[model samples]
Structure formats: C-alpha cells, structure tokens
Target: MSEHKPVPGHRADYRHFHAIQTRWMDNDVYGHVNNVVYYSWFDTAVNHYLVASGVLDIERSPVIGLVIETRCNYFASVAFPDQVDVGVRVAHVGRSSVRYEIGIFKEGEDSAAAQGHFVHVYVDRESRRPVDIPEAMRMALAAIAVG
Candidate 1:
C-alpha cells in the first residue's frame, strides 16, 4: 500500500451514490469478498451512474466508453451478505477518456472497506476510435469530480 490510506469520513466528489448488497457467492475460499468482485463493483457503480444520468444508452448509443485501465487497494476484508455503499468520483477527465475513482464501504460504517479506480475511454460506437466527450457526458462527469 502507499503512504496514503483511506480513513473514515472521507467523501468522494461523487454526484450520486448507489447501494449494493454483497451476494454469498462474492466470497472466495478465505471467507472474504474476493479481489475480483471489487472490480465488478467499480464497473457497476460507473455504468449505473451513466445509465441513470442518461449519458449512456447501452443499447442504442452512438458513443460508448471502454475500460482502458483499472487498479484497486484492499484495506480490509468485506464478507458476503454485507450491505455495501459505493462512492464514486471523477479524478481526471480527458479529451476522450475519463478516470473514475471509487471507494467501497460497509453500510452504516464510515471508512471505505476498499478503494479502486478505473479509466473509461469514450469512442465512436462503430469505428471504436476515441472521440471527444459529449457535453452532456462532461456535465454528468463534472458533477462527480471531487472539489
């Protein structure tokens, strides 16, 4: 881990939040939520936000954001069936890519159970080439940037 550690009361510059319940299968042999599942949570958080914000029309949008990179830091163990709250923020917004950072916490708890980040590069639906972020999307992402 880095010198920096996530602590209680830390709020991400997230415009919205969503609650997710951990499923029993989310755990691996050791009894803690597996590392892989954390990444999925990151995806679910960002996608759900975009979908609800009307920035993404998963089925018919002429534009799409593709995952270009990802990273995570697990500070503590979270078990299955636990109520988890996710906080998200836009760390960086580029011409065609946006970097989203997320923190996972146990419901009713303060500090994050884990933290992670992922970058999504928006591109043309058909060409799959990078494209400038639409104004609407930019506005949506800005709402999530940490001050």
Candidate 2:
C-alpha cells in the first residue's frame, strides 16, 4: 500500500482565517521565518478563533484545551515584514479532543506556504483530566469542521 503524502491546502479548504503580522525577530539567520515560529502561529490562530467566538475564557474557563500533538509541512518560505493569514478547520471533534488543521498563507496568496495540524485534548482545568467538550465550544468548532 502506498502512503498518502500531505500537500499544501488552499484558502477554500478552511472555514476560518486569522491574520498575523510577522515580527522581525521571527526571521532566523537564514532570513526566513523560522520553522518554530510557524507552530506559534498555529497556536495563536486557533486560540484567537476560540476567544473571538466567545467560547473560551482563558482566565476563567473551567475546561482548557491542551495540545497533545502537533506537526507541520512547509512548501515555501516566508519572512518578516509580511502579513500572513492562517486558515483553520476541524478535521475531527471527539468527546474530549479535537484535531485542528491549519494553513499559513502569505498575504493575498491563494495557496498555503505551510500546512500543519495539532490535536487539543479538552481537560478539566483543576483536575487535569479529560472532559467532554462544552456545548458552546462544540458549536464554535462545528462552524469550522470539515470532512
């Protein structure tokens, strides 16, 4: 059997997008945004969406989503002084976990410069045990779900 390889996704593949401005410090000695910075963008994009949708209260929410896994693939390089847009979509939403796919695109570009995913497991903030996703959070996630 042949394994399926990941490919860059287009803007239409995602349901939501968040804009991020790259800082000069994001660039590495090679003059391109460092690979590690892309991961930060993924976290920022997803959290920003959750907060903007009114489903997450970072300071007081009883449940929190903690990243359990993350992976990324880069097709092109991006640098500082560029505004990038990150597209987000939910690939899977389990009772206590969600698989979120993300894409980073240069301003006005149609295809992603990088694509990645991260799994967030919802857990009780105090107990640190897995918990069912909140209804409001589920609803917000539904808005960005994909097959």
Candidate 3:
C-alpha cells in the first residue's frame, strides 16, 4: 500500500523515459515487489537522465548531487519479468537543488504502477558544500521540467 498522493497529469509531464525490468529478487512473500524497490526505480530513472545528459560526472566532477528528500506512492503491484516504464520530469529546479518527479508505469499501461519524487542538492565535490547549479546542468534539467 502506497502512502503518498498521486499528482494528476503528472504522467504527461514526463519528457524522459527509462525502462526497468522487475527482477525475481524484488518480490516479497506476498508475491509483489517490495516497497523499497520503488525508491531504487526513482534513483534509476533520475540518474539515467543525468548520465545521458553528460552534465554529471560521477567519477570526478567538480560538483556532486546529494539526495536530500524522497517519497513514493504505489497504486498497483509489479511482478518479476514485468517491464516498467519510468517517466521522469523536473518538478522544480533551484540554484542548488532539483526536484525530479517520477512515475513508474507498467509497460504499455496508461497509468503508473508507482509515483514519487527524489530531490538532489548540488554541492562542491571537495568541500561537499552546497553550490549554485551550473548553467549547463540547469539547462539539462529544464529540458524535462514540468511547470
């Protein structure tokens, strides 16, 4: 049972997508995917976009993104071997933070299996202090941002 609210029309706001296949280990005794797995999907979806954009250098970038907040709401159950469509969009972008909204849908389904958000605050790699988001990074994030 998901404990979060579903944002209407959020599905349409996502401009980027990632495909994630459920694995056997993801299932619990009740025969459904565990709640924690949805969080992983949130990470997978957001990071996939960042990596694809080439603005985030995970290995040696001068700046790094740190997760500050997260939440999810499950509307349906998912099983092993079932592919999921992860829709992503930026709900907000700040000088030093970005809030990514993600909807996890069953493949070919109109609605989401789960919906949630993950917020990342950019910081200095060395100092680990918060810093303004770079122009390039901000632009990349905006490409998928919804109003």
Candidate 4:
C-alpha cells in the first residue's frame, strides 16, 4: 500500500465557516464518525452557504448546481457529540462550474481534521443543460475565492 500525504488546512485559510453537530448515530461500530458522514457535512456546508447568500433556491431556482466530482482526505477521527466547524472557500470558478474546497475541523481546533473539494456545475433545473453562473452568484463566489 502507498502512504498518503495529508493536505494541511488551517482555519485562517477559509473565508466562510459553518458549524455542524454530530448525532449519536453518526458514530459507527469503530466508535468514530463514519467516513460517509463527512461527505454529507460537505454538502450541507456548501449548500447552506449558497442558500444563505441568496444564490441557491432548491425548489424555485432556474439555475441549480449539480455536484460533478468530489474528493476527501481524512487525517483524524471524530466521534459523536463533537461539533465540527467546516471552512469553505472557492478554489476556482469557471463559466459553468465551481470548485469548492472545504476543511472540516474539530470545534476549537486550528488545523483541519479533514480536507476535500467538490466541483459543481451550474445547470438549468428543467433542461439539465449547463448554464453560465448568474452575475450575482458570480459575485458571491468571488467573495470566497481563494488563491
């Protein structure tokens, strides 16, 4: 097996943040939160930001973001009842797609326990065709764009 290198991310690296509470069911047989739960957290954090920013309206929006790709790297284990602070940043924004980088940190910790990214392609909800990001959405994305 090959050794994996951890992607280091600090709280200061992100421009936005969202807090997630872990439930008792989040823990698996191994006594730590399951790996799959991390992905859910990622989705929650990003969509929440978009909705709160008035860029995404799940039910009424003509333009919607569809996740096309996702990846994650885990460096530590977290159990139930632990609050997670998710750091969010836009790594890249294309004409119809945006790459969102996220860092999951244990509450009050400085460094991320896990880090990953998801790419979302903006598309028309009805036609399912790629659409250019709206100007307002573009501006919102720029606010979180990272180097």
Candidate 5:
C-alpha cells in the first residue's frame, strides 16, 4: 500500500456538502468529537446524497451499497457546539463499487478538520452478491466525480 499522509483539505475540493450538527454525546473525554463519530458523519454525508439524488431507497431498493473499506485522517478537533459541514465527492466509480471521499469542516473554516474516504460496493439486498451500479446511481455519482 502507498503511504498516505494526512493532508488537510479545503471546501472547494468537494463537489457537494451537507450540514451536520454535532451532538453532545459525540464528544469524548478530550472535549472534542470522538474519532468514531467522524465515520458516522462520513456515512451520513454520502448516504444522504445518494438518497436525495433518487439513487437510493434504503427500505425498498433491490440493490444496496455495502461499505467494504474506510479510512479517516484527523487534522484538527471539533466540539459539540460546532456545526460540521461535510463535503463529499466521488473519487472513483467502478462496476460494482464507488470510492466516496469526505471532508469534515468546522463551519466557516476554509480548511477541513478531517478528511477520508469509504468504498461502497453495490450488491443485491437479499443475495448480498455484487451487482453493477444502476444507471441512476451512476449518473448521480458522476455528478460528484472529482477530477
């Protein structure tokens, strides 16, 4: 594997964004948002976009995306009172999987507090077998594809 240095990101680096409110429970003993909570934000940002784009129906879709891999790099800390702006973009799209890159920014900040990516493989909801991405999903993802 290649060494991936934790480089901070900027808002302009992402294609879309969703506002996420940090809950008090999200903070750890350090008084900042816990590392695990960032992953939840990542999931929320990506899934929300998919659902809003009409590409995903969590309850009724025959095909669903299953997270296959994920990673995050924290550059700074965020607190409960902060409104996190989660920026999302598609780094790559494959036959059955898509790599979604996410950036968590403290509201109004130009630089990202955290940045990372998760790979989701589309699969049969019942059979759990990999399936080609649907046309609607492909189009939606393409809209967010990063150069």
Candidate 6:
C-alpha cells in the first residue's frame, strides 16, 4: 500500500472561507461528526462562494456545476455545537472542470480539523453535457486559484 501524504490544513493556504454551524444530528453513533458531513461542508463552502461571487444562479443559470469526484481526510474530531470555518481554494481549472480544495477549521482556529477536495464539471443545465466554464465564472474562480 502507498503511504498517504497529509494534506495541508493551514488557514493561510486558502483564499476564501465560509462558516457552518454544526447541527446536533450531524453526529453519528461514534460521537463525533459523521464522515459524510464533511463532504456537505465542502460543497456548501465552494458553492456559496460561487453564488456570492455572482457566477452561479441555482434556479436560472444556463450552466451548473456537477460534482464528479470528492475526497476528505480528517485530522481531528468535531462534535455538536461547534462552528466550522471552511477555507476554500481552487487548485486547478480545466476547460469544463474545476478542482476545489477545502479545509475545515474550528472557529477561530488556524489549523484545520479536516481537509478535502472535489472536482466539478461544469455542464449545460438542460442537456447535462459538459460546457466550457463561463467567462464570468472563470474570472470569479481565478480570484481564489492557487498553483
């Protein structure tokens, strides 16, 4: 088996942040937040930034991003009543896809409790076929892009 390299979880590594309040139901029987909840945070952070940047319109946009891949790595446990600040950055932008990296930090913490990435393939809303990212969207993404 290959060794896993730890993902960087520093706040300085990301360009944008979105806060999410942990819900009581987010905890699984294991007592910590469920692994699945992290993915939702990732989605929320990235999409929220896009929407706020005026690049995404969930109801009327001609194009929409579809998540094609996702992953997460946990470094610490998070429980109920905690506020998570998810840091977001774009690692790559392709013709029709973007790779968003996210770090989940406890409120006011500089280090992340979890980190992950997801790839979104932009597509035509009606046809469900891949389409070039809109110029406006690309410009929005560029503001947070990293090498």
Overall lDDT per candidate, in order of appearance: 0.87, 0.97, 0.87, 0.94, 0.96, 0.95
- What lDDT score is found at residue 97 in candidate 6? 99
Q: Per-prediction count of colliding residue pairs?
A: 0, 0, 0, 0, 0, 0
How do the residues 1-147 of candidate 6 rate in per-residue lDDT, one tens digit apiece? Answer: 899689657999999999999999999999999999999999999999999999999999999999999989898899998999999999999999999999999998888999989999999999999999999999999999999
Q: On residues 20-89, what C-alpha lDDT tens digit does candidate 1 reach at each position? A: 9999999999999999999999999999999999999999989999998998887778997898888888
TM-score of 2: 0.97
C-alpha lDDT of candidate 6 relative to the true structure: 0.95
Could you tell me which 10 consecutive residues in candidate 4 have the lowest summed lDDT?
1-10
Q: Write model 4 residue lDDT over 9-102, tens digit each, in one string.
A: 8999999999999999999999999999999999999999999999888899999999999999988898989999999999999999999999
After superposition, candidate 2 runs with Cα above 4 Å error = none
Q: Which ten-residue region of model 2 has the weakest summed lDDT? A: 1-10
Off by over 4 Å in 3: 1-10
Would you estimate the TM-scores of all the predictions? 0.91, 0.97, 0.92, 0.96, 0.97, 0.96
Q: Which has the higher lDDT value, candidate number 1 or candidate number 6?
A: 6
Q: How many angstroms is residue 114 displaced in model 2 relative to the true structure, after the best TM-score fit?
A: 0.3
User: Model 1, residue 112: displacement in angstroms?
Assistant: 0.7
Candidate 3 collision pairs? none
Off by more than 4 A, model 1: 1-9, 12-14
Higher-scoring candidate on lDDT, 2 or 6: 2
lDDT of 3 by residue, 1-147 (tens): 877555534457579999998999999999998999999888888887888899887798798899999988778889888999899999899889999988988888888878889899999999999999989889899899888
Worst 10 residues of 1 by lDDT: 6-15
For every candidate, C-alpha RMSD to the true structure in Å: 2.2, 1.0, 2.9, 1.7, 1.3, 1.0
Q: Which stretches of candidate 6 lie over 4 Å from their true place?
A: none
- Candidate 3's error at 72, in angstroms? 0.4
